[model samples]
Target: MTVVNGYEQSDAEKKLNILNLPSLADEAKKIIPTGGYGYIVGGSEDEWTLAENTKAFNHAQIVHKALSNIDSPDLSTNFLGIDLKTPIMMAPTAAQGLAHSQGEKDTARGVAAVGGLMAQSTYSSTSIADTAAAGNGAPQLFQLYMSKDWDFNKSLLDEAKKAGVKGIILTVDATVDGYREEDIINNFQFPIPMPNLEKYSAGDGKGKGIGEIYASAAQKISEDDVRRIAEYTDLPVIVKGVQSPEDALRAIGAGAAAIYVSNHGGRQLNGGPASFDVLPAIAKAVNKRVPIIFDSGVRRGSHAFKALAAGADLVAFGRPVIYGLALGGAEGVQSVFEQIDHELEIIMQLAGTKTIADVKHAPLTHFNYAD
Candidate 1:
């Protein structure tokens, strides 16, 4: 347990942070602005998919073995050629300044502190340059949103390369934003300025690329675009927001270096299957052609283990990192990563696994209900 400024170490270490993810979320409610908290916690209409995301984990149970070598368990793994201290990385959650004043800068620092990687969002409150600088050149990836402006997108890619980003994760889920009931009810909009887009002068540029394309719907990203993005730069292009085997295969065919299995954290689509539910098939489809990065409904160490067993090469933490930020800034965020990492080690030791590779072979069973 690490001590944070303005928070007593013993109390936070021995008590507050000891609580589970849900409790930390509750604590975030007390700290974050009402609308901001709503945006952070809320999903699409009815939140059925959001509920199902976490609920789907209940269907799988880890089976531990006895009388196996259990001296030291290694949680380290590589993601797309980057050496990570742990298999856990931070997901690209936009508008992080809503959670803390420091925004993505603090989040980067926290992730680097815990020996984890961070995927900085394109719409981050802090600029990509600043976020990368704050992380002190730690292993980082840039999450790109295909903007209506092609020049803007090219400039962003240039900026990301200049920032020394290790990889490029092109988000394919959030094209026009989802219908978030919480944001509507609370009248919540993004709070901080997105300085990253200042170079291109976006947002109010009257780019009607949305409804002008396929079927009068805003912004159509085609497989050719994916292929172009993959070839645009020498950096690895990982296609995020792949939920099905078909999409997974298409992304790989388009030359994606990896597949990110997510449903936009159930924020974009209202009634899609949980990320975990669709992971196995997608992983099988990829057939280890590239790495698989999994996100959505990952709240516990066991959940991460299940994602690994389901074929995710790495698991990312999203809302929980925001909760940690709201609780104690960078230190709190690091503690959250450490806690999950610790629990993951415990699960590994109990399961008689010595490395992350062994996690896939760990015995597992499915249950109809939560135990």
Candidate 2:
């Protein structure tokens, strides 16, 4: 943790940190304890997919167009009807309280400071209304879960709308939690202080998973219930966690305003295709009917650039931001976004583009997988 002002230092000084998106992973590891760190940072066994997520970016060489009026790059864009100063939005990650005491409230402030959006996860430590208040009720996106009860699902959607959330994202990918081998081996649940998690679930008759005297929380929802929730939310509902082109199309046909292509940062379903690999075809299948967003393994300008080149309208990085929030609080989180946004500008100029429009359709060879 590099000390700036009164904040604790991140040990190793990171270069290209205008966005503080963890240019290095080890620095991120130092911020949180082994249990919390393993839950957020660890991936599947062998970790081949997690490793490939980063390695996939290395294979793409930026074809910089020199002398192309590289000055004044426009990094702003609108996502799901909400305008953003930068195309980068904070991807939803749960257990933020475990990252920092301020939890999602501080994360919300950081997103507002940058004029970007933060997707409030269903598992948020802070409730949706509180996060909305923290962002000064800035245009936000509420990420949803497929809970067992339809009435409970309806209530959450209604609550988000009343809170003035701009859009609702149905996280279709987590039909169940991902297989995080580290947590399994380490016996971690990223526990929250009492009365909070209990408050979130007391109505549903659930308790902590790792409690010596408690039981695991189960999300009991079927595919039919997912469509019902999608239909229930009037906001632009995005279907997250679609890795296959077919799944992406299904989400669109099922009434998704956008598709968030992610494999849960390779934490779930180890050995799945990196979000980058499936982006091109997924984008093509949607064909402008709905937006296509990509994440999982993006930690720098080049990563964002590659996602754009590969046809992602918007992108976000999870663990990197978590590290910033855990390490430095709101200011640290702002630094993460700033570092990525700054790198995005440099990458835009170097790639011979001025505005985001100039960034479209760089050619790429696709390696397809049958899922």
Highest lDDT scorer: 1
Error at 44, model 1, angstroms: 0.2
Work out how many backbone clashes candidate 1 has: 3
Q: Report model 2's TM-score to 2 decimal places.
A: 0.86
After superposition on all C-alphas, the RMSD of every candidate to the true structure, in Å, is 5.2, 5.2
Please give, for residues 1-371, the per-residue lDDT of candidate 2 as tens digits.
33322223233222224434555357767766677677778787778888888777765566867777558789888776778898788898876766677778888988898998888877786878888899996778888765554555666788788889887877766655555678777777435633223334433222333332122222553345446666676677778888887987777777777888888788767778777777778888878788877888888887898888887888877888878777667777787888888888988888887776667665544444333
What's model 1's lDDT at 362?
78
Model 1 C-alpha lDDT versus the unseen true structure? 0.81
Q: Write the per-residue lDDT of candidate 1 for residues 1-371, one digit (tens) a residue.
A: 22223311111211135466666887778767786788789898899998899889988889978999676889989887788889999999877877777778888988999789999988787888999999997999999888777788888888899999998998888777677888778755454557765665465212222122111221678778777776786888899999999999998888899999999888989888998999989988999999999999999898999899989999997999888886777887888898888889988988888999999777679768743
Residue 46 lDDT, candidate 2, scale 0-100: 72
Q: Which parts of model 1 are misplaced by more than 4 Å?
A: 1-16, 204-218
Candidate 2's displacement at residue 104, Å, is 0.7
What are the Cα lDDT values of the candidates? 0.81, 0.72
